[model samples]
Target: MGGYLPETIVTNDDFTKMVDTSDAWIIERTGIRQRHKVAPGQRTSDLAVEAARVALAAAGRTPEDVDMVIVATTTPDMPFPSTASIVQQKLGTRPCAAFDVQAVCSGFVYALTVADGFVARGIARCVLVIGAEAMSQLLDYTDRGTCILFGDGAGAVVLEPVEGEGTSADRGILGFDLQCDGSKMDLLYVDGGVFEDSNRIGKIRMQGNQVFKHAVHKISEAAENAVIKSNLSMADVDWFIPHQANQRILNGVADKLGLDRDKVISTVAMHANTSAASIPLAWYIGVQDGRVKPGDLVLIEALGGGLTWGAAAIRL
Candidate 1:
């Protein structure tokens, strides 16, 4: 796994100058001390490319070896060509099957699930799965509720097929449980889109209370169901790496699962919510800090707009 954050950092106090919010208020409510922001010329694909390079290097592979590229991002640089395509060209990757997945914060897992299918079916030998977002690009700086809750970053992983006994003990993605409730769209959504005649992009709009309620419930249920599908239980998981949406939500999910807090990998306090990038970013941190190790059983999950939520069980 690999992760990348832009050089610019926005602290809670910085939001105080932009909106009627304070460091204490932001930290107390969202547990976000600061977040990374893209520079003026930076875009989602830029972050994705850097992250992909790091992941490819870590896997001891190169762009030429990649057979497929999947990028999960809501804030793509443009609407025409996919971000994965942009990353491919920028990285000088050979022509390959490339595209984008937009499940928002649950994107990484969604992308991972797709990559798994391709490799499992012997369609792709080396797949680069990335979750990247320039969330700041879509935020309304004046809207304290949304602006203070996001940042820009990317995380990536290389997925390749491995011989496994087809059991829960497999040292790779074992199972996944994905679900979405379009009916709950109002709970979290962007207010504008490409359909707007003004050609203006919409800012994020969220019903925080409603989202918090659903996130805690759905995330926990999805995680549990995923582990069960892997023929394993919560106790078998060595780490719980979830979307870094909110520290409260992370704790809430851990509590619901009766899982130890120490077992959870969280980066929200530092990165805020990088949307799709959160899971892999946190996973990268955990591994870097030596808190997470190879061969460990990991359960990753996330909830995002579309009321989309899912979980993946893996032995890494």
Candidate 2:
């Protein structure tokens, strides 16, 4: 029915001793004042379960009502036990298909798109989709540029079947587009991975300038494409929820799309970039603060490490 984000959080200043960057510098570049990091012993599934509980409660449904669990994250607790399965077990849901979707930061949107199709195609009645991350484990605190840009958090949404007249005014997902550029993989990626690197965790590495450039350009195009696919004009969009990466990237996309600054929903100023968790977290905050409401046309877009980018147009 809607979205949910954790209330607990941590500020950038809290990381001052853990890294070399200052709060002023982080805020100036990323617009992030704080973020929610999982406790040392906290697992990704723990965050997912909490968020799923809130979302299911909001939808007024029990776990048994859910037909699928889709978790979007790059930082799964283990390489073997899918985070979705762990969430399924924790929620005590009836047997249901469960899996994880990995597309880096654009993961949530990608997962949401998949869930939307599942419902629309009559494969599922109710779906619980979660975007959870524990990026703190991947951070190389010594690298200020990358270290300062990420945090840990989770957000979830409940998507139920809704029939529409097959038009842009449809209440559920109206339009969606997903794209990937393998050529840009080197721009933002970890140095190692389980399958290829002997199961060793990799250090986060990024070329901020290049990623920023492509992010602004691709995100703008993806947003426009989604709008067009929905058969609606940009002016019809009431809220633009872009990926919470850098403040500059958000600004550039907003400017290029000709959307009013105020029309953009920004939690990055506080949440930093939770990667997959960013959009849903922003959506949850917007709803909680009364910025998002029923009947509003929302445009969601994201760009991340597979060089993956995606967009969705939804009428709430």
Question: What lDDT does candidate 1 reach at residue 230?
Answer: 93
Q: lDDT, candidate 1, residue 2?
A: 89
Ten contiguous residues with the weakest lDDT in model 1: 193-202
lDDT of 2 by residue, 110-198 (tens): 99999988998899998999999989888888898888788788889999887688888779889888999999999999988766678
Candidate 1 accuracy as lDDT:
0.94
Candidate 2: give the clashing pairs.
none
CA RMSD per model (angstroms)? 0.8, 1.6
Candidate 1: clashing pairs of residues: 295-316
